[model samples]
Target: MPAPRIKICGVTQAATLHACIAARADYVGFNFCPPSPRFLSLPAARDLGAQANGRITRVGLFVDADPATIAEAVEAAGLDAIQLHGSEAPQTVAALKARHGLPVWKVISVSGAADLAPAARYAQAADLVLLDAKTPKGALAGGLGLKFDWTLLAAWRPSGPWGLAGGLNPANVAEAVRVTGAPLVDTASGVETAPGVKDMDLIAAFCQAARS
Candidate 1:
């Protein structure tokens, strides 16, 4: 089998970005959600993205942000893709992609088989889909450091590429891939020493484990 694609999200620091690139991560995600501890200012995200060059993909993560905000971040950060981690309607996804001309990744929180139904709607509008663990109501949208049943994704197949996320770490990533057979995986709090602090060693180990 091919190596599993690794996307390290919630990156704020230049060193952490460097760590991810050095680790051969397939994608690096920058949080634009102000509520997230890993959030980055537009200027900071732009600087970090410049550092990435063409070595890895730069993804901008947002939650129910307006078009103006999304446009500003995408221009300022030079993002290659936008990750929508909210209750954005399919129309919103279509508008964002059409207006910005950037690929869109729609994240749907799945807790059960019923949750998978939403992917079909998103797949029609999004360039990719991210199946993540649902955060409880009145909580932060993502990066809550939680995990759901991997079996929930065993039978999931999307029209476009998809990724598995939530509560994935170096220790369990191999098993997570084994169970889901996901071609791509994303990590945020799982690789952090704290809410916003990334552990370089953990990042490297995660990439290695996911590939091995």
Candidate 2:
């Protein structure tokens, strides 16, 4: 099988962006949610995105942000795609894709087989679907560093392209691929030394392991 595409999310610094690129990451993500420690200001994200120019895809990550917020980030950050990591509906995904003329990746939190049903709802609107671990009630979306059962995806399929994420580290990435056959894989806290702080060595290891 072809190697799975790797997307390193929650990148907040230029150094981290460079590390991801050096690791040959297929996509580098920037958090736009202000509450996140990995959040980047428009200018900061713009600078880092410029550094990634053409070497890898630049993705802007957002929660349930308003359209204006997304528009500003896209303009300022030069994003190639937008990842909606919130409780957005299918219509919202379609609207964002149409408004920005960019690919939209919708994140679905899954803890059981039933959670997989939502993928079909989003597939009609989103260009890609990201299956991530469900966060605890009343918690923010994503970057929780929690993992769900990979076995739940053993026979899983989606209406569109899809990816696997949440708590995926270098140590288990190969096994993740072996089990789920996910075409893409995304990570954030898994490569971090602390919450929102990415470690270069871990980043490199994850990319290498996933590629191998």
Candidate 3:
């Protein structure tokens, strides 16, 4: 099998965008969730997306965003796909896909095997199901840098396309892939110096490791 696709997420600067590109990452994510440290305004996201056009697939990360807001960001940023990191229903995913004419990635937060149920629920509507760690109740979603049990995938089989995320870094991404056989892998905080701060060297190391 080919090496897994790598996505360096939550990019907030032109330099970080370039860093991901230089690492030959397949996808680069821009956060649109305002409360996130990595969140970017529509104009900022648009400019960054423009700068990376044609170099890598641009994914806009949203958390429980409304239709109008999603439409606005899609048009403004020219995103290649939308990653829903919220509790959106399968119907919501389908509606967004139909309305935007772009692929949708649904994030499935996993604390146990039961959490994997939604993957099947979203299989038909979502282009990709991103398996992420479940945050503490009442806490913010994703990029918390917490990892779930990778052993959960030992007997798990997804019904459709999927990506693995959560606390993946250069040191352990190889093991993550070995254990999960994921075709696509995403990381944000793992390569950051701090929340929302991308470190180019770590970005490069991570891509190399994921593709190793």
Candidate 4:
């Protein structure tokens, strides 16, 4: 099988953003969700996004943010894509795609096989459907280092483009791809030493492992 594409998310600093580019990450995600430790202000995102614009794909991560807020971030950051991590309806995803004229990725919080059902709803609305582990009620949506059963995806096939996230790290990402045959893989907290603290070595290791 071809090596999976890699996305390094929750990047907060210029050095880390440059590390991701040097590491050949396919995409770099900037968190727009206020509650997450990796959240980026508009100014921070713009600076990082400028550095990432041509060298790597820049994706803005949001969680049920109002369209106006999202619009501001997209414009400020020159986002190439928008990734939704909330309970947005298909219409919301479609509308965002129409509004921004960019690829929209919908994250599905998977706990069981039933959770996979939501991907079908986003077939046309989303450019990519990302499967992430489900967090507890009142907790942050993702980037918690929580992992789900990768085997749960063994028998499933998605109609649209898709990727896998949730507790993927340098040590285990190869196994994750082997088990699920994921075409793309994403990581946020997995490459971090602490909450929102990205480790350069970990970032390099993750990229190498995901492609290995």
**Top-TM-score candidate index:** 4
RMSD of 2: 0.9
Overall lDDT per candidate, in order of appearance: 0.91, 0.92, 0.93, 0.95
Q: List the residue pairs that clash in candidate 1.
A: none
- The numbered model that scores best in lDDT is 4
Candidate 3 has a TM-score of: 0.98
Instruction: Give the backbone clash total of model 3.
Output: 0
Model 4 RMSD vs true structure: 0.6
Clashing pairs in 2: none
Assess every candidate by TM-score: 0.97, 0.98, 0.98, 0.99
1-212 in candidate 2: lDDT tens per residue?
79999999999888898899899999999999998988999999889878888888999999999999999999888999999999889999999998999999999999899999989998779999999999998877888888899999877767889999988999999899988898999999999999999999999999999988
Q: Against the true structure, candidate 3 has what lDDT? A: 0.93
lDDT per residue as tens, model 1, 1-212? 67789999999999999999999999999999998899899889879988886878999999999999998888888899999999899999999989989999999898899998999997789998999999999888788889899987767777778889989999999999999888899999989989989999999999999998
Greater-TM-score candidate between 1 and 4? 4
lDDT for each residue of candidate 4 in 14-56, tens digit (9 for 90 to 100): 9999999999999999999999999999999889988887899
Candidate 1 vs candidate 3: the lDDT winner is 3
Weakest ten-residue segment in model 1 by summed lDDT: 152-161
Question: How many residue pairs collide in each prediction?
Answer: 0, 0, 0, 0
Off by over 4 Å in 1: none
